[model samples]
Target: MTYLCLGLSICVSIPTYISFMYIRTLRLNTRFIIVRNIVLSVCLRDLMFLFTDFVTSLASKPSYLCEVTGALLQYMSTCAFLWMLCASTDIWLKVHFPYFNHANNIYFYRSLSYISPMFIVCATIGGFRSGYVDENSCWLSITSQSMWVFYSTAIVLIVLISIELAMVACKTTQALKNSVQPANIASTKDPKQSRNMAKSFLPLLAVFGITWILGIFLVIGGTIIFDLLFVIVNGLQGFVLFLSQFLFSKQVHNAWTESKERATTRTL
Candidate 1:
């Protein structure tokens, strides 16, 4: 079952990673920059999972390899969630302060997403040392006291993202009800634009948020059912994100269409 889950995850993640790379090169939006980083982080995390959880066990490697792989997996996974938080915060900031220089702040977001995880992993390793890796697998042992450091940080991030999304939803609802054009609302005169902005972020929040929420439960002594569900749902996260943000995105579709047409014109 573990092999099945990891296989499915890697299969989906590779294509999703490729699609994101293509879109990132062409889109050139501040939002896509955050999203691209998120996807890349997830892909790397999945790869680390393959090595630490699967390959290391089969190879019967030494404990230090497990420690290193565990640390890398922890770092990359934390980076993925932190990037998700950044995305949520970006939406919240855009909704509340429409004219804010988000592009300029992209550097700050990137730094936070990458560096914060390093600190968490470092603290865990520094404090626990040998406790960072499970003897049986190249991962933080759920039974270990040091594991809380990692899980707690993930929970806090999940909570923060949920709060930001809720606030954005409320603000958008209020704007639509009042029928007033706030700077934070859409730049266009349309009243529904605020609602649209809120709606657009829902799928992303749902996918990452719900998957990790289930993960938290599984870690906290969930049953076999919870374990299975987490494996299947979490494995599909990249594919879901691809469907919502890339494959079905009108912006992506239009961009591709325009690029093809431009190529045809150049050919002519």
Candidate 2:
């Protein structure tokens, strides 16, 4: 999972960074560009979480060190998913509202996304502290209360992502069905007739959705299994999901390459 997540992070972060760069370089509207930038930032968060997870995964006796690295991992993993929830909410707004225009700046939206999590973090700080460091390994294991917190957070994320995926799927299916012609060669012909925004969205959406869904299950299973094995499988599952997103798509690769070039030029 560690490798998978890191690989996915590299895969996603690079292209997301590039795509935003390309959008900025183009004559795009400020608002649309801002939205894309927000999404790119979320991908960056995912990468950070992946790195943190990879580190924790490598350390010996990870569970014993839940106070330091484990806390960091929890923060990253939780926040990354929350950021994705931001993406879903943003996209859902775009789809549902379509014209509820507001002049709120990018900072406003970004701040909005972080504010809720910050509150939760603050609440958690006082209420649910990791009491005894297991001292076994570098993995994470909060108290049963924290366990519940983590579980709840994971469930919320699963639900939110699932909602986004379902929305995307329904929209895509409808669009494709609408586009199909009557029973003729044209319908199943060599050349395609049309494509909808929903269709264009499916590949990325599927990557995002499927990976997380599969990942959450793995983590749950790991937590239930014997201690040492739990960390291994859970971490592995998270990485798998992360990697799956990037591996299953090509555009993500292109975007990543572009971002690297831009970063290189800046460094030079």
Candidate 3:
């Protein structure tokens, strides 16, 4: 059942990743970039999961693979989560400070995206694989001291995610106020103004807040229940992780819908 669930997620995620990459070329946006990052993160993490799941899948071999792949799994996930933290921060700042966002749209931020992704991956692979293998895959296996490091990093991600979400909320409130200003009547250019300014990016926001909080709590609490609850949460995390990949396609669908509408109206 576990493998079945995971297989289904990969099935959905593979095409979603391909679709997001295609959409990236056509109609890119911050939301798409964020989603794309998450998809890639999952892609890498799932590869580790597949390798490890094999040990768990068949005869509980508990192979010495964790001594090797363990670092990649941890690093990929940490980088994935950390990059997610960065995305939330970037988007929140962008929403609050449009001018700053315009700066990011130029080139440097684009470069950061590429560079930072690989940096996180390598940093993980290099830093965390000392004495981390026990019987199964557990953080304690990383070593006595590393568990603290893991928790500390988790705390950092939580702090960053929290701050960014707060910033975004504040921006939403200010946007609402600006949106309702007395003189800002709904005129011809208002469509563009409203479309650009509303900037809910609600799906992206939900992905940020929901996934982080849920995963953090799971990681923190996993040592306690450590059995049924932990497994269930991990299962759900897999579901949520893969599920977020689908949102990237919504914008593509929106564009297509609008295009079709325009074509129909023109023909009529």
Candidate 4:
């Protein structure tokens, strides 16, 4: 678990840092700004979880330590999901109504997306302070009271993502239908773009799905396999987030290609 956490932190942090420091195009784009927040949220969540686990392991009585770490974990994780929801909704709007004017309101929309999750997290923590360092683990425990908070949020996120995926599919199907007929030479293939967005989004949905599904299953049946899967899925969330950026992000690929070209020119 320690090694997995360390690996996830390194993998997620390096690209996240590079994207902020070096990717000028990504910084300028509103969509990428939402993505950047998601990246930062995932990185912080992973690193904080690692730190809390490490500290809790050493402390004799991790009473206060548990509360602090557990709260942070909840906040950061929930923030990531909310940011993802924002990103998907933005894309859905753009795809379904490409001509809609958003230039003036984009910043306000982005701010709302970023700010709303904090309130949800605060409410959860205040309403139910059930998360604590478990006897065996140094992470948030899914106690009966806290289960609803964590599981309900997770379920909501998954449902939202699933809806976004369906929207993207519809956009893609329409784009493909248009592409098949005699159309203008320069007409944009919206489906291709939607496909890319969906590709990047699916893994994030999968991460949430796997973790929560396994968790729900364990709660219901308490099987060994479900228990093992829950631990594995929970532990590897950071790594999955890191992978999704590379696997699904067209901007990340473009940035990499441009960087490679620059490197080659410098060498020449």
Candidate 5:
């Protein structure tokens, strides 16, 4: 069940992320770049997870394979969450302080997405050499100390996502209140665009929240129910991300529609 869902998620998300890559407008936008990177990271992480699981099942004692896969798993999964943090932070700043220039710091945001996770994963691996395939799974087995690092990261992300969601809610309410004004009526951009923009993060938050919460619970105790929950939620992570990008995002949606039309015309 776990592999099945993760496989399906990868199948859907990779093409969706690739579609964004080809869309000039989405490719150029700083916020969308963050989102695309997030999708890319999640897809990579899920693919790695599936591959490692398959390899582990086939070779009982694949020497040093566990360490490599575990390190990569840690790095990629951490990157996914951190990139999501960057996206939320970027979006919140854009919404709250509309004039602030994010374009100048796109490099900075991109650096965080890659660098921080590499540093943490390297430190963890070097300090303890901490990755081995257990009887049932191939991952960084959670010791008391290592578990802290993992869960702590998730906790911080959850807090940041929560704060971003609250800010978005407040902004959406204010936008709605002002949307009734005559001056707002005269604005060039659709007022609904702002509301839609604010609501976009809701699905993101829901996906991150549900997946990580299941992870945290699994750490606390594992039963059949929690195992099932973890598999389904974690497996859905990539697909949820793809849906958030392709379905909810207006720019991506428009670009995708245009791409399909172009393809259809060429086929004729």
Candidate 6:
């Protein structure tokens, strides 16, 4: 089951990441930029897990390899979470403030998304010395308190993102209501526009929030039922992401259709 899950995640994630890279229209949007990074990070994380946890376990390997893989996994997972937070915060600011400067602060967001996790992983290794890797697996040692660093960081980021998304939802709802009133209808913007804006953030919020929250629980310990649930939901995250970000995206479909039409026109 674990192997199946990992296989599915890698298969889905690699192709999805490649599609995002090749699709010019997808790259033009700031939101897609953040999402691209998220997908990349998750892809790397799953690959590392497959290698260190499954492959290495089958063979005799040095201890340092496990430690190194543990650190890489930690960094990639944290980076994915941070990117999700950035996405939520970006949408929240845009919804609340019409002129939020996402383009200007994109570099800052990217830096935080990537560098912050590196810093955390480095600090954990430095502070704990030999405590980073567990004896039984290529992951943080729960006994040495190193695992909490990742868990605590994840929990905090999840809470902050949830708050930001909740506020965005409330603000969007209020705006939608205001747009419908007779007196405000003339002055208000289109409710459909507001709804579309809200819809854009929902996939990220639902996928990242629910899966990771369940993942944290599964890691901490859970029943067989919960473990199976986690394996299905959390393991197939890449598939879900592909569905939400690409397959169901009208923009991507339009972009692909237009590109094909242009190619055919040139050929004719």
**Predicted model with the maximum TM-score:** 1
State in Å the error of residue 18, model 2: 4.6
Q: Which regions of candidate 6 are displaced past 4 Å?
A: 55-59, 180-204, 215-220
Give the alpha carbon lDDT tens digit for every residue of 1-268 in model 4.
Answer: 5457546655876676566557676676666677677777777777776777677677476477666776777777777777778777777766666666645546765566556656765776676665533544545565635646767887888798789878777767766787652132112354576567767777777886887788778756678777777767776766676667654556787976887788899999
lDDT string, candidate 5, 1-268, tens digits: 9879998889988888787788777788776788888888888999898878876787466557776777788889888888878877776666656656668767988788799888887777666653333434667666524655766887788798778857756765676687552342223155455556556767877877787787777877778898898888888888887777687666777877887898899999
Which pairs of residues collide in candidate 5? none
Error of 3 at 2 (Å): 3.0
Better of 2 and 3 by lDDT: 3
Relative to the unseen true structure, what is the C-alpha lDDT of residue 191 in candidate 1, on a scale of 0 to 100? 42
What is the overall TM-score of model 3 with all chains considered together?
A: 0.66
lDDT of 3 at 267: 100
Best by lDDT: 6
Q: Which stretch of 10 consecutive residues in model 2 shows the poorest summed lDDT?
A: 185-194
Q: Give the per-residue lDDT of model 6 (tens digit) for 1-268.
A: 7778767878988888787777787776777788788888878887887876664565677788888889989998899889888888777666656554558767988899989888999999998887788857878887788888888898899889878877766766776676553332222265444445447656765766676667677667868877787667666767667777778877778878977888899999
Q: Global lDDT for candidate 6?
A: 0.76
Put down candidate 3 lDDT per residue, 154-231, tens digits, no spaces.
567767766766665564555456765223222222333333322433443354445445545655554544444434
lDDT of candidate 2 over 25-121, digit per residue (tens): 3214333344354344445445555555555556464443445554544555565556555545544554444455533434565665555556655
Better of 1 and 6 by lDDT: 6
Candidate 3 residue spans exceeding 4 A from truth: 24-27, 55-64, 101-130, 138-143, 177-226, 241-252, 258-268
Off by over 4 Å in 4: 103-114, 129-144, 180-190, 247-250, 259-268
Question: All candidates: CA RMSD in angstroms?
Answer: 2.4, 8.3, 5.7, 3.8, 3.5, 3.3
Weakest 10 consecutive residues, lDDT, candidate 6?
A: 179-188
Each model's lDDT = 0.74, 0.48, 0.53, 0.68, 0.74, 0.76
Ranking by TM-score: 1, 6, 5, 4, 3, 2
Which of the two candidates, 1 or 3, achieves a greater TM-score against the reference?
1
